[model samples]
Structure formats: C-alpha cells, structure tokens
Target: MAQQDRAVQTRERIVTGAATAFYRVGYADASIATIAETAGVTKGALYFHFSSKEEIARAVIDEQHRRVFESAAEILQATASPAETMMLMCADLAEWLVSDVVVRAGIRLTTGGAIFDPPTRAPYDDWLATFEDLVGRAVAAGELRQGTDPARLAHFIIPSFTGVQLLSDVLTNMDDLKVRVGELWDVLLAAFAEPTRLDELLALRFRIFGPAS
Candidate 1:
C-alpha cells in the first residue's frame, strides 16, 4: 500500500512539473529532461510513469477537464438559477486559470492545436455542451431574453471567454483575468438577460469577482 501511494505521488509530481514547464514555455519548447529535473525525478522514473511528453500533456488536459466538471457539479448543486450558475462557473474557471498551473498549461495546449497531432477538440466540445445546458435552463426559467438560441449563446460564450483569458494571459499574465471575465459578464448579461432579471444576474458578477477596484 505504501509503495503504491509513493508511486502515485511520484506520478503526480511529474505531471505537476510538466504542467509548470509547459505553462512557462509552451508545448513546443518544454522538454522531457527539464520536466524530469523540475520534478526532482530521474528520466527513468518519469518514463516509468509516462512514456512520452504527449502522454503527460494529455494527462494534464484530462485533469483540467475533471476540475472544470467538478466545479460545474458544485454550482449545479448549489443553485438552480442558470444565470447565476453560469456566472459562478466562469468565475471559478477564471480563478483556476489564474492560480492553477495545470489549468493554464492544459488550456494553452488545447488551443495551440499545431502542437498536438490529431488535434483533440474534446475540451471545447465538453465546455460547449455544458454552456448549452446552462443556457437552455436559463431560457426555460425566463432568465434569458426571448428568442435566445441556447446553442448559439453557448458557442459565443465559450469562445469569448477563451479569448478573454488568452488576452489576459498575454497582457497581464492572468492577474486581471477575473476582472476581464467580470467585464465580459457585464456585457453578456446586459444583452441576453431578461430585463426583469438583469440586476439579479449582474449582481452575481460582483460576488464572483468582488467589488472592482
């Protein structure tokens, strides 16, 4: 049992180290030797856990997706109001992207498709489905304006958020991501939310991002 636990810890260390390297240098520049050195493990140990850099990158992506879904589940359990849930979900992800190395690296790799052979779109598809479900629920609840297309809204929101984060990363190293995302919600809620629910929906922005400076 102890040996298994140690092995798991070693594997986690390697993944974390790889994520940090990838986040700093991107997939094309990150090397296995550097990752192994950062993890404080020999190359042989890294190989024992992960056969290749792509495998490590894939693991990081999978872990990031898992965290996102976990956040979604928590939001769903806490609130039935889809607008509130969506805002909160975005807030949670923005926070993660700023603070979590794995999330930063995974998203960078997912969007930098030239780095990956076969170019997986699973992360985007999963997020799109999640946003679609949330928007559909909002429309059903009359929180969204009439004639709002859930699919269209989902597609827009996902890419917009992605762009916002990418810009934040480049401009401020994500120090301002939470603020940028709040600004995005300000625009989106004003446009899409029902007039009666606009104030309530907009209020969630403050809760997630806190009072703006």
Candidate 2:
C-alpha cells in the first residue's frame, strides 16, 4: 500500500511539475530537464510515469477539464439561482487560472496547437451543454427576457468568454481576468436579463465583483 501511494505521489509530482514548466514556457520550449527539476523528481521517475511531453500535456488538459466541471458542480449545488451560479463559476475559474499552474498549462496547451487524438472539442461540448442547461434554467425562471434562445445564448457566451479569457491571458497574464469576467457579465445581463430584474442582477454583479466594479 505504501509503495502504491508513493508511486501515485511521484506521478502527480511529474504531472504538476510538467504543468508549471508548460505554463511558464510553451510546450515547444519546455524541456524534460525543466520538468524533472521543477517536479523534484529524477528524469527516470518522470519517464516511468509519462513517455513524452505530449503525454504529460494530455494529462494536464484532462485534469483541467476535470477541475472545471468539478468546480462548477460544487457551485451549482450551493447556488439556487442559475444566473448567479454562472457568474460565480466564471469568477472561480478566473481565479483558479491565476493561482493554479496545472489549469493554466491546460489552457495554454489547448490554445497553442497541442493535438490530442480524442480531440479537445469533446470536453468543450460538455461544458457548453452545462452552460446551456444553466441558461435554460435561468430562462425558465424568467431571469432572462422572453424569447431568449437558451442554446444560442449559451453558445455565444462560452466562445465570448473563451476570447475574453485568452485575450486577458495574452495581455495581462490573466491578472485582469476576474475584472474582465465582470465586464462580460455586465453586457450579458444587460442584453438578456428581464427588465424588472436587471437592476437586481446588476446589484448581484457588483456584490460579486465588488463596489469598485
């Protein structure tokens, strides 16, 4: 049992170390030596867990998607309002990207042309489905204006958010991501929220983003 646990820990260390290297440098630039050093493992240990940088990159991407869904599920369980839940989820993810090296690596890998056989779109489609369900709930609750197409709105929001996140990463290393998310929500709420509840939703936004927002 102890040996198994140690093996698991070593594998995780390699994955995490590789993630930090990938986050700091593009996949093309990150080297096995850097990953081994960052992970505090020998090259042999890393090779035991992963055959190549490509395998490690794929692991990081899988971990990122897992974390994204896990965090959203936790928030959904805690928040009754779907609109508020969506905002909170985005805020959490923005902060996560800032602090979590593994998550950051995954985002970079996806954007930087790292190819995986199963493809990355499958996870994105699941995410879109989650967002669409939330939007559908918000529409049903009358938080959004009538005639709002939940599917279309969800599809739009996800890609718009991807652009916002990617641009923030490029321009600010995601230092401004939380604020950018607030901005995105501001426009989204203005466009789709029911007139009677727009003010209330905006107030929620301010509370979430702070009065400075």
Candidate 3:
C-alpha cells in the first residue's frame, strides 16, 4: 500500500508539474526533459510512468476531467433540487476554472487543439452527456420549468465556463472576473429560475457565487 501510494503521488506530481509547465510555456515549446525536471524526477522516471510527452499531456487532461466529473457527481448526489444542483455545478466548475492549475492547463489545451483528438474528446463528451442527463432528471422531477432541454442547458452552462476560461487567459484582473461571472450567473439564473424564484435566486447568486465587489 505504501509503495502504491508513493507511485500514485509521484504520478500526480508529474502531471501537475507538466500541466503548469505546459500552461506557462506552450506545449509545442515544452519538452519531456523539462517536464521531468519540473516534476523533480529523472527523464527515465517519467518515461517509466508515461512513455512520451503526448501521453503525459493526455494523462494530465484525463486526471483533470476525472476531478471535474467526480466533483459534479458528488454535488449532484448531495442535492435533490435541480435548480440548486445546477447552480452548485456551475459554482464548482467556476471555482476550479479560477483556481486549479491543472484545470486551467486543460482549458488551455482544449482551446489550443488537443480537444480535436478522439481520445481527448471522449472523456469530455461522456462527462457532458452525464451532466445533460442530470439536467433531464431535474426536468422530470419538476424542479425545472416545462420544456427545459437538458442538452440545451448543458450547452449553455458549458460554454459559459469555457468563455470565462478564454477571458481568464487574456484578462489579468481577478476582480473584473468576479464581476463578469456574477453578471453571467445573474443572466443564467434569470433565464432558468421561475419568476417567483427570481428574488431568492438573486440572493442565491451572492450566496453561491460570492460577492462581486
């Protein structure tokens, strides 16, 4: 168990280090030698775990999706209300986008061309499909309004996160990010929540998303 744990930690360290290195420097510019060095392991050690740079990149992205999907599932399982569940999902995604180094790297990779690959897109497609199914469940539960399309809701929410990711790459100010995200959530809540629930949702915006100020 100890050796297994160590191996897992080492692999994770390599993934995280490679992700940060790739994000800071373009993947085209990053080399396995450098990644190994950044990860504090020898090139042979890296090779023992991952045969090539492409494999490492894919592993990093896969781990990122694993974390995101796991978090989403946990959030969904914890809540019975669809509205609250979706809001929490968005919040969790946004929080990771804003904070996690690995996820930020994955976002960059997605926009940079890695997502065009079949293996790269597979996990993402599965995750999105599952999330959409959750939205469908919400609709069936009557937590969402009539005619609410699960795929459409997933489409809208996913793009919002990616849009923020693109903006984060260019916009250096975190304060502006908070305001922009708050406004975006306001628009989303307005569109999805019942009219009678708007005021409560307005309060929920601050509660879930935090203060924009």
Per-candidate count of clashing residue pairs (backbone under 3 Å): 0, 0, 0
Between candidates 2 and 3, the one scoring higher on TM-score is: 2
lDDT of each: 0.87, 0.85, 0.75
**Could you give candidate 2's per-residue lDDT for residues 1-213 as a string of tens digits?**
699999999988888888989877778888999999999999998998899888898888888878877988899899459889888888888878888888888877776654555556756687789889999998888898888888899899888888888999999988788888899999999899999989988988887865433
Best by TM-score: 1
Q: Global CA lDDT of candidate 2, please?
A: 0.85
Candidate 3 C-alpha lDDT tens digits along 138-210: 6676555568888988877666756775785677633355556777777776677656667776787788777
Candidate 1 vs candidate 2, lDDT winner? 1
Write down the TM-score of every candidate: 0.94, 0.93, 0.85
lDDT of 1: 0.87
Name the better of 1 and 3 by lDDT: 1
- 1 versus 3: better TM-score goes to: 1
- Segments of candidate 1 deviating more than 4 angstroms: 211-213
